[model samples]
Target: MSALMLDPASGSSVGLLVAGLIVLVGAVVQGSIGYGLNLLAGPLLALIDPALVPVPVLMIACVQAALAVVREHKHTEWRGVGWAMVGRLPGNVLGVLAVASLPLAQFNIVIGVSVLVCVGLSMLSLKLSPTRPGLVVAGAASGAFGTASSIGGPPIALLYQHSTGPVVRATLGAYFLLASISSVVTLLIAGQVRVEHLSAAAVLLPFMLAGFAASGPLRKFLRGPRLRYAVLGVAAASAMFLILRNLF
Candidate 1:
């Protein structure tokens, strides 16, 4: 059993610890700006262990999203969330099928490139509103990519790019809370989620919560355009990193 399980003092455990710290940083960014846990940490964690990619990251995201939703419940826009979910279900199913049957490397490459393109478009000042149609389309795309890559925040984040910081954080938080649930369920049904994934998430949960707690003081400093720019920069960098990591 000792050999089978990760020993805390071992190199593998150190890697896990490093991964946890990365998660902590990602959580801070998510708590401050509302959607970055997966984007920031997903790629790094995947490099540490492929099993840590989507499932474990999604589990941690569920916790982070739920906490964000609770902290900013009053700002949630249920109507928009409803519309996004309408499209998310089908997209999620398509994503799950892709994960089950398709070549994941090629699929990930496609997603990475697509996200980079979308982030580029967003940076060009093309305004995407959180309207019903926009939300549906963004939600579907988010579901598809998120289910596959665990990097779902970009689509919805770009849509609400021009909104106020609080609205962006709260609405994205709410959407992520729901979207994480759907992704987890789909992954479970598809036999992708396992006990080890849950174990890894459990080990990393404290770091996530700690980072979130630390972000409370930092959030006040990142309001207005500063917040918007920060979100865009992080999203763009993460997308680019995903593309580069997959290609090489």
Candidate 2:
């Protein structure tokens, strides 16, 4: 975890600029298509410090999830959301514990592999419907990855990919909101939720809100195929980046 901590010196103006760009762009994509911020931000931030990756990313996720759920409240699938919460909460506790003891590099490797494998299966036509078992699995996986790397959307996204627009957005928004809430609790229990970091996340909140505002027009214009392809491309690249980083 120490290896993942942010270096104060590395938080230069240029680094902050780059991080801000990531937040802006990632937030737009997330706001437009229902998710992608951490997928895009985590690996990019990892280049600065892997230890630093989880907290800021989680912070942003907290904000993103809240906004998303607020925006898409009407279409949420109550059954799936309820079961997902049940499975995720305990798993999040386990994952937070892992964060204290597990190496970031190793966790990255595992999460990277999991993302690649899940995405590949989706690409291979293995449908991940939001059934009871699938929801449970996705929830548990989301909880673990959310705690471990602040990148919890892939498993849940895979499930929602084939769903209708409203269903997908509502399902994902709800899942993320709940999982993030649980992850925050776990982080607090683990004493990893720092006040300073929360302050930093607060400062970035406006950027996320701005991005969401900017995305409103674009969301109506973008079709499903275009959005999915864009998301898949980014997610695949991030997964590969994680794998290669671990390998070297």
Candidate 3:
């Protein structure tokens, strides 16, 4: 891979503030439901600059993963997590390779399509429980897409949703934590990691944390059908936006 590079800075204090607010909100969604930050960040930051947006989302995934591992560590399904990691690690490498070969527009299109597919399947109630092959498939897809598009959660989220509540949360959290780390490493190796991106992510970390903290009380207020409908709505809207952007 080539050396990592950043564009001449395309953001200002104002841009940063706006992006940070979105990241915070995304984090709250994730903290409350165990996923959605990337789905949230994608459209919000896409309005800024698509190239720069994925970096912050990826970085924030790392932070969220760390937090998740801490919160759900005791319940993590180590076997599933380990198996999924095997698939995800290699899939991430493949995704980076794919990105390296593609033009920017093509890359964006690929990511958009993948995200839309994930959302569509999710809306249809196809939850994936982690069996041997299931773990592998979900892991590979999540890793590849997470690095390429910052939309890795859907595949794993769908997978974990079939499990019991704690199991679902623990497995999804562990998978994301692992996948997020792998994505950051892959980006570094592929020369996509950038100083400005890292700086932006660092500045926004506290906001993400605050968002996560903010969700604790909200969870009680939003339960069962209400929460499902809200999250599904967000996911569907996100998918539609991605498809529209790709087509336009």
Which candidate number would show the highest lDDT if scored against the true structure? 1
Model 3 regions lying over 4 Å from their true place: 1-11, 103-127, 221-233
lDDT of 3 at 163: 50
124-228 per-residue lDDT for model 2 (tens digits): 878677788888888888888878877887777777776655666667777787787788778877888765566556545667778778877877755576666
RMSD of 3: 3.7
Query: Tens digit of lDDT per residue, candidate 3, span 43-116?
Result: 66767656555676788778886786687678788898888888899889877877778664566566666656
Top candidate (TM-score): 1
User: What lDDT score is found at residue 80 in candidate 1?
Assistant: 85
Give the alpha-carbon lDDT of every model: 0.84, 0.74, 0.71
Q: Estimated TM-score per prediction? A: 0.93, 0.88, 0.84
**lDDT of candidate 2 at residue 142, scale 0 to 100:** 83
- Higher-ranked by TM-score: 1 or 2: 1
Model 2, TM vs. native: 0.88
TM-score of 3: 0.84
**Candidate number that wins on lDDT, 1 or 2:** 1
